[model samples]
Target: MVSSRIVDYHEDLVEEPEVELPQMVFADGEEPVGVRVLTYQSSRAINTILNALNEAEIQYLRESSFGKLIEIAEKPAFSGRFARYLLSRQLKVEKKHEAWFRFAGNPIRFSLREFAIVTGLPCGEIPKKQKMKKKNINEKPYWPELFGSMEEMRVSQAVKMLRKKTVTDPDIRMKLACLAIVSSVLLSTNLKMKMLKEYAELLGDIEEFLSFPWGRIAFDMLMTSIKKRDEISLSQDTIALKGFALALQLVIVEAVPALTEVVQDACSSSESESDDDEIESPVSKARRKTLNPAHAREVDRKSEVNIIFN
Candidate 1:
């Protein structure tokens, strides 16, 4: 009879040399990159908008160009461990700026086109920033109209302003949602990220603003964050990554079928596990020949397009 010892590879575990580094360090060795994703409570801002609006207003928001944002706002925050794990698999290429990750051994590119498909956001070539700035030169500044005269307000403060009974206009409400989503969730560095006049300018012409490639802008920012993390050496202690880090996680989750089951919120119970004891994703098992071939077929059948919130 065939020996069970040969079949049970799980029992063939061997100890590998440790990288010998401090806790929360993933910039070196054979381990996954230990970068953490920093995101704000986007739900709060979204709730504020929902509560402040009437039925017509809510429905209008649902049908707007920025409508998909409502779904993104409610998505479960990506697991920090999984986020780092994806980053660790990022393959080095001849072009330093090209973002690529090895998923179940196949290379997946996180290009702007993929980002757009995953996010359903506009990905224009000319940045929204430049377009907004150019508008400022031509006519009235968008800041005065969109945000009013709050020079030093936090992103939450901007979202909270909508709560006042006076902000009943639909345009103003839409503008508020745009600002809130951008600062509080999309490109936020932290909860205290300040309001930027550049983005506010886009809100002036809602139609034009919707057409502008926000996905490209956001993807670029996300790419920039990844590049920075890549540059960090083993000695650096950069733990937190900002600016739409969740997008990177989202694209990876969309591409890798096995990862869909393992993705968790950053604040979930998985946080309790040590880096060495991190919950292995199914792809990890497949890599080690531990996963059944039949299971892989089931994974392949699941739709790759993971849009909409559950």
Candidate 2:
């Protein structure tokens, strides 16, 4: 039988000393250039060489042994604009690639110069300066007396003053009247009715007031208040509703012509049954009887006011 032996590799584990590479030195007779070159095993170094080569050379390298080196190297993904910038710079191999590598991923923010560097595009130009016109310093403030001391005056006195202002300064009168109407509406139930009645009496001929834009504004306010009747507290809703109804009635009485035109337009548009196609159902007969001209005339004569109470 042949003798068999096994080798032990554990004995070969020895510590090696670190070796330092030699630095270039100038000879005594030769002048030192004072310049040094450094290299990195980084993607930027490979990119620098790749960027310089012709298309054929690049293709040949990519298919040869150098292809493995390119694959193993840490080449950064560059944006189209940033790649153009790198091409524009024409940087050398072994350069400090870290500065350019920092912009590899999406940048959080960038200065205009850095943006231009990466994008290879110019920054937006600054806008031209403009001259401003001076405003008039001596212009007097308008209607200073309208708000001042008016609250201290009695209701009668205020009304008289507003009436006087109405002819010469209608805007101020409208403002004051609108303010009074809003204040009266917001007061407690009893006070609200009292104040509104007083205002109605003070205005005297409601028709004359409704002729102005301010009267239309007051009319709108009254109608809006009526529509919001359900939103009022149950305790005050009755009195408030009555007041709004009365106010609206008074306005409508004054603006009857405009209201009549609207009513006629509405009635004309409603479907009417012709005698030829008329159906004689009990309900239809009753409705026709109620709407008959003779019966309507009798009712109109009895209630000269021509207004629906509701």
Candidate 3:
């Protein structure tokens, strides 16, 4: 289990003996915005509401799936510019498990191993799609309550519903927040995101949901998207990166601390958020009559994140 602070697994691998790498390769461009998860308020709620519950003698934060993640969010906003620059330098590779970036003339590999350390997320293998695609899913506690008649709900819409103050149960709220973070933040990309039914069903047991290897799924989503686009597509004026670009940014930082002063962070830069991710009033009827009602864009199969790993 990861403590409050993320360990430098990258540093452990590099060791205190190796000669330091050169300055990082730099690039200039308009950074594409990843999904704007409602972390600002959601994190607060976790501390104020979720942690205060009488669930156990131990603090809920210690036991939560996203305990370290919430702590990471509080540190600083995602560095979209830096992340984009790193992606631009990605080298072509045959393997899908890891991405190699040419940083300071040295190749730094960002794989599930590095991702787990930087993000403090479990990188366990996910169950096969065939097993997860069981029938009669609507009966699950989360399916009908969160979905009802809505066939396809966007990740943003699900975040909105979960962020509502009306959902008073702390345990329930914690589970929903996990879904929001996974669908909205970790796997965020240019294309509109839909809440996976399989993900929602897992919330039926918070323990099972926590036990799942979301980090592996997130890594696969990001690497697949990167693999999908080559240098040409990344250089195009219409570049939209898939997966959580920030993960790459953090990994880059860990790999080379010298570049920290060079790249511009999204928070300090006050980078304007993408219109699609701007936080909307959960109470807005135009968006959805209720969480039980309308939501998000249809999942584009072409760009849909393939996290159903064997």
Question: Which candidate wins on lDDT?
Answer: 1
Whole-model Cα lDDT of every candidate shown, in order: 0.51, 0.25, 0.51
lDDT of 3: 0.51
Candidate 2 runs further than 4 Å off? 1-143, 146-154, 159-212, 231-237, 241-247, 251-310
**What is the lDDT, from 0 to 100, of the residue 96 in candidate 1?**
45
Error of 2 at 59 (Å): 99
Among all windows of 10 consecutive residues in model 3, the one with the lowest summed lDDT is 288-297
- The better-scoring model by TM-score among 1 and 2 is 1
Order the candidates by lDDT, highest first — what do you get? 1, 3, 2
The TM-scores, one per candidate, come to: 0.67, 0.21, 0.64
Please write out the lDDT profile of model 2 over residues 1-310, one tens digit for every residue.
0121111111112132243211112212232221111111111223333333346545654453234323322212111111222112121122121111111111111122222222222223322210113324673322234445332332223333443333245444543443333222222132211223223321333233222233223334433433342212211311222111222212222222122222111111121211211112222222211022222223323423333212
Please give, for residues 69-103, the per-residue lDDT of candidate 3 as tens digits.
65554433453434444566555556667676654
How does residue 57 of candidate 1 score in lDDT?
67
